[model samples]
Target: MKVLVLGSGGREHALCWKLAQSPLIEKVFCAPGNAGIAEDAECIPISVNDFEALADFAQKEDIAFTIVGPEDPLAKGIVDFFEDRGLKIFGPSAKAAQIEGSKVFAKKIMAKYGIPTASFEIFDDPQKAIEYVEKKGAPIVVKADGLAAGKGVIVCDTVEEAKEAINKIMVEKAFGEAGNRVVIEECLFGEEASFMILTDGKTLFVLPSSQDHKPLLDGDKGPNTGGMGAYSPAPVVTPELEEKIMKTIMEPLIKGLAQEGIPYKGVLYAGLMIVDGEPYVLEFNCRFGDPECQPLMMRIKSDLAEIIMAALEGKLAEKKLELREEAAVCVVMASKGYPGKYEKGKVIKGLEEVGRMPGVKVFHAGTAKKDGEFVTNGGRVLGVTALGKDIPEAIDKAYEAVEKISWEGVHFRRDIGRKAIKHLPPKVLIFAGSKSDLPIIFKTEEVFQEFLVPYRIVVASSYRNPDKVRSLVKNAEEKGIKVLVAGAGLAAHLAGAIASETILPVIGLPLATGTLGGIDALLSTAQMPPGVPVATVTINGSINAAILAIQMLALSDERLQKRLLKYKKQLAEN
Candidate 1:
């Protein structure tokens, strides 16, 4: 049997290389393959988008199966084209590909199926989009409805930036027809993971979770790119998370697509945000991700040809995919400027020496053999993949290989698996109206310390120091404070004051120090205005206040959520 892989990225190279190792396959071929892919399979000269030509070549060459690598070809109806000619292919049809090809289509499906996703609104008119952004405020996301080669989504921290993104996409048509319509959504916070599965329109074969670094620089700073690097077995996606994603996002989407008569029959990629041990879909891709595929192909121990054939034959339930115990990491080496204009055609060297090392494979993305030397042909040039017993070791090995290769202007993120190395401390803020409330406020601090929830205490009277209170709350919001606790005795209003300044949840503690048995404080804090609400605890309930604040913060924090759950379980047991 002969197999043909479409596209010419590192993903296609990895797929072609893995299929070549299959004993069930007689030969492997890649269309418009890069210089590195040419080393693994027969490189053909055909554009993946030329559906008619591709179908003709597949028939003429007797290619037993064809696998589409990139979302562009799938979005362009490559699967339907091949299938119409009775040619076997692996990928979602164009109708199903719209889930990835159109943000609006994906959002509608998610909304219809009750799939967890960020709340969003679609807009074809640029002015309406700008108006929605203004109403929703800053820290929102702006996205082009159509594909923009992975650079269409803009996470804006300010409304001005979001407005600029809308103008660029819709007004200026920065991404051509892709930006004609737009989808704006609320920005969700948490770690992101790639959840991929092979499905036969019904059954699914889940792959190991992987995380892709989208930013250009280390520490997740700078503009988004196709992908800077990726690693399999992401610690962010625990077993519980995997189950939640399957039940909430992936399964619903597959069933929903089938119910709509699409019956997706290929790899379904769910871009997920794991928030507070809960999963939400960021977007969907109909094909395997690029850098993610590089690492996955390195870690998968099963025969690629057999698995894909089983999925296509609707026998996926009988098959189980095996993975190597070791973790795999892939770091992409690209031209100096990427996800934008950059100089290409720089000579890349040392690939042979790097490939000679154990557990390392260089999958070329944009390179060509010119005069017997590999020269950079696109922004993302090569993916340096490595395997090790653990993520740190895998990252180190991958970097070691990365250091071996060089070009005129090369750049990559230094912190690939750094999130797995250390966890950031959770933070909360406490504001007391008077120094007289310090004793109970100190008790709240003790509770936070016990729970390992870092906190800061401030003395600011809402009525007397309104400016100071507003400024402190604004500062805390800027510092990324997850929740706030406000303590006051007489006519307590600190919580309401703090709540008015920021969107962060606030808890109120009515102190028992003042006269009238603290009734005045309790009632004042409890009866808040219609628009401004405060979660009020009992009189002198500082401990409960701390717990409540932490609970609110844990909504987007996985570690904190676990700790809180354990504490609650202990309470029940006691």
Candidate 2:
């Protein structure tokens, strides 16, 4: 029926836009909405943080359901206030909101529940924070214990920098009361993934994983903003990894909150770190993320109003949330010198043209109507999103839309999916006899890394499991791996086993691990049946195995040839 959204940012605007599309929603209203949000829903004049005023307005208007969009109101007990008055609100109580409002509180809960996260120490006294920084060297993370608009965390590379950050946050009050306490945490290196779930304090419904660009500038070389851009279905968060994250991170936090009498509801946003197949919790957000939400809403197949209602009514277990199999990408357009000083109110152009592009939609983040014209009113202006059957297609469509929209000094990363391309079905699989032959395979690894070729390396004992070798070759053929590299030491049957199973090209690497110094292995690998062929490389030569694979992949990819040539040039200089 009637839905009331509380917030005044791009995220709130996107929520309002999605909610308006639901057939279940009869009417929608947004409190102090932006120019873009005004396009779909009625905009009220009450401030988002004004609890009493918002409650009064909701009651007077007989709003059927209210959804809190921002974290501040939730932390201020706005949801509890509404619930106490018998109003239907979708958000967690103030106690549950602490999972995001206070970093120390979250860390303590995670620690108590044995959740995997970076080890950290909390300090309320400025002197104590400085002492911790002095004891722990650089390359650590310093974060404000409370919310600081996503700019409170600093990755310090030196002890001096960490000390300076601590002093600024704790002593100088750079972030005001939000920085009265600080958290110094160990630095964990890995790819970051965002895992969000809809919950009703008991049952959890997971959403697709998204990778967000936190830094303001390209190449990840600038200060953090409220996510410059985000893309969904990130390859790093495979189905296997998502399950692990839910078990290790999300489940514990949800159960922990309930045990503490918070009984959390609505979205639980978990920032995660995937390190070598293991997932660790990085941070928590009380509500949906801004740029991340823009693309996610584009991909979700379920009704927005129904999902919120289910979570609020404790019927999330009975509800089924679905998402499209396609990939979604969102590129944020921001004002020049964003996350810093920048001018606003500049007229924007080509929004309609961009949104009209195939599979593209524009969600306004910061804009206001002046004289019937859209003008920028905040640092991040809009989230241009596109969906496609796959990431490559989505990237192309997203950029197509991006090219149409224009604003002075707007910027985004051109290589958002560069890392993801590696997971694309590998063109080759290289198998070695033993770990001793790793040196030979190292060269192949280097080649694949240099050329950005998708490939995998496996160590197999040919003699120990001849049948397993046959199975491996059979599976490779079934999966369409184009080439194979077989390396062995003595009595090298690796090539023969591969050749006997498949008609695909096989390169043999002879390692000098035997008493005969690889002569037997070399001879055996070089000789093959009349119909079967196995290409042979020099003794202990893994580089040639890589070269052979590259040549096979290059037969179909002309662009890869140019990349290989550049890699060769860089190698020569080194």
Candidate 3:
């Protein structure tokens, strides 16, 4: 099957790269792609705005389906245009795309559904917007009603700045017609996180959580550009926080859209503000974020074609995306005077050497081949992405690659993913082969609760959802889940599978089930390939699993070690 991706940025390049790797895909093509994308897929010069021309090309080329990378075409009803022409496409309908196209529309949906977001008022008159800002006082947010390529919203610290922002957006038309109206909101203060998910209008599959650095200068001290850099999975958006975002933000938004007669599909990217563990929506993007997508694509282990097909065919509930356990970082290299006046067509160097580095990629957002040499073609030039054991390592690896490649006026952020390095605390995860194993799991949970150890429980079938299990296990270490406990009956290979995914210690609790008197489970749980090991407990020995997990954790935790000794003394006395 041939697939067409729209847009000309790092996001499109990453999409093209991943989609081309699908066995089912005969060819992947990108319309108006950059120099980097040309290496991954055939690049077409058709403008994304020319929907008619694109539809004709897709039909003539026998394109199986199309994936949109940017919000422009989606906002212009490209999905509807293709579907109307009886051609397959992936993206939200124009009405649904309004969530990203118009801030007013998104705010209305949030307000109507009681989805948590900032309180705000809308205004078409420039003076009215300024008046609202003055009344709201400082520390307010002013946003253009329409799309501004990730630069429409301004977080104003003072009333003067707020008024000036209103004037710039509404009076000077800094963002074109998008500034005809403005949204003045009470600023929601917190760390920013980017959460994206794929949906079939009913089923939602989460992509990894990532954080984007938007400001132009280092330490977030400049005007916003498309994006400076990004990393995933964002430590701030913990698993618990991801769940909350799904329940309180993603679910309601999808449900609310359905209620309003819009079946939202494709990617729903929530630009979030997480405050005191609560997630609040700052804005929504109907497409994958550029820098964020680059790193996420590096970590994806699943076939992109399959996931997109599942979403399009309404079979997404049965499919899950698997990503590598390692963390990913993308550092955007821009022209010297980016988010402002900048010259292009300058020669870029060192790309070949950077490409030779393992676990690294340089995705071109703006470049062209001039006499077999790469030259800058746009404001944001390349996205240097790398995979590492954790965020810090990934950050370093990405920057190392960045250092190799340079142009006359290359620019980038120095502190990408800096905020998360100090916050990730190791956690313990318990995996049960099935929900039926909950009885065994409860025993483990009891010990953890008593000892005040932080842990999470997951139920996945190593037989049925093998990819999910592998993904969970592989990602455990980076997600701060340092210890794993697998409980299963029968052949009991779940623990072994978890053990194989990572070097993290795995404790196996064999269940007492079946006709073999639980002996089968005990043996299989104990057995593993050469050098791979599982700390097996006796049949139905869940208490032992919990104690072992805590013991492993206590190796580095002095307080926990003391607590475990006290618990051991009490058990001995009893």
Candidate 4:
């Protein structure tokens, strides 16, 4: 059977690539594909949004079946259009796609059906939203109601930031028409996981649980991009948690839609937060997630075309999908200044070298074949995906392949699967504003080494890269880190910033230079914002910072407490 898939990103590429491997599929065609997809399927010049043109081409080519990948076209009722034209397509209908196209619609369905989710209030007015934020306080979540290509949600740390998000989405229209309405909700604390299922309005075939890294930078800090990387199966989603999600979220959702007369079909993606070992729905996507799909495709042991056919032909209950035991990781390579203005058309090299590496597939996202060469055509350029026996090996192999590929202004997150590490949990984290603060970092390291404390040191500027600091704080907590130490010089906001983002004890080590020495930074550290508190140490006090961190950890650790006492006694005697 001949198949047609509509999309132009890494997701579509994976779908096409996998479908082409099916015994039942004789040929595969992608409406609009990137440079990498062209090798797997016949790449047509027609755009995904041009439904009429796509329908005409499908009819002309006698394409046996069609699959829709991206959300925008699906939400616009492309499935309805194709079905009306007597063409079978894979995806939810227009009305059913409101589960992703409109956040308000999805939230109502979840609430009405008793699906577990965060408490939320919808708003169309900017002023009312601002008022709501002011009353609710900080650390709340503000989301644009409609589709925003995964950039609509904002996790605000302050009332001011929440209000600004309200303004950006509702007033300034940051996401175009999609930002006209907003959903403000209480921020749920937990690690986030993505769950995807194949449903034909009844039976559900669950895919491997995966975690998507949204921030553009490593350590979970930076502005939200489409997705930086993803790994499957997510370490946080235990089997128990998966059963709960199936019982509470996925099953009810399909049943509710069926009762509402919306025949839900195709992939249903639940963006979930596993809070206190229970899954809470953050959002839902009508189709597969991009980077998540990349990793999932790499791990699939079953024929992709046959499974989708079962869903389309109402034989989903009889069909089964198998996944390889190996864990897969996908790291997105993007042009610099991505999630914003970026330069394109840079010559990309080293594709052939990467292809020779075992178990690695460079899924192209934003590239164009021009004059026999692939050139960067969009912000996210490629997804370097690899499979391994475990998460760490998969991450290593993915990064190994990622290093082989290059384009002008190419950048990607270095810590793709850092969360899946199981060797040992660090008790403390030491952060520096810059490598210039190494003198202070060395002292901090010396104390940790002497005390036999397991700690990790990172250099990230709170001002230059606030998102990195925020991500570092969040990761520290997840990694079971007890305390944090930050060192900086002038305008030292490092400690204060880290303190505000997390509840863990933070010690500030002030480094001074130039005329005022370190007094300014000392005051900045000592006098943090009214609510955000920082344990400030003296000028160039890296040793004390580490000692203070150990002291905090010692509060709950008798071994550390006794060791700390001995050290203190030795210092006094000396």
Best candidate (score: lDDT): 3
Measured against the true structure, the TM-scores of the candidates, in listed sequence, are 0.75, 0.80, 0.75, 0.75
lDDT for every model? 0.88, 0.84, 0.90, 0.89
- Candidate 4, superposed: residue stretches over 4 Å from native: 422-574
> RMSD in angstroms, all models?
13.6, 5.9, 15.0, 12.9
Clash count, candidate 3: 0
What is candidate 3's lDDT per residue for 23-89, written digit by digit as tens?
9998889998978899999999999999999999999999999999999999999999999999989
| Worst lDDT 10-window in candidate 3 | 418-427
Candidate 3, residue 559: Cα displacement in angstroms equals 28
* lDDT of prediction 4: 0.89
Q: Write the per-residue lDDT of candidate 4 for residues 1-574, one digit (tens) a residue.
A: 8999999999999899889889998889998987889999999999999999999999998988899989999999999999999998999999999999999999999999999999999998899899988999989999999999899999999999998899889888989999889999999998889999998877899999999999999778989889999999887887888898999999999999999999899999999988878899999999999899999999899998888888889999998889899999999999999999999889999999998999999898999988999999998899999998777568768887888888778999998876655222578888989988887688887787666566788999988999888888998887888988888989888998899889888888889954789998898889987878888889998888888888887887665686788798998999
- For model 3, the stretches where C-alpha displacement exceeds 4 angstroms are 426-574
Higher-scoring candidate on lDDT, 2 or 3: 3
Candidate 1 TM-score over all chains jointly? 0.75
Model 2 over residues 183-222: C-alpha lDDT tens digits? 8999888888788998888789897788888887766777
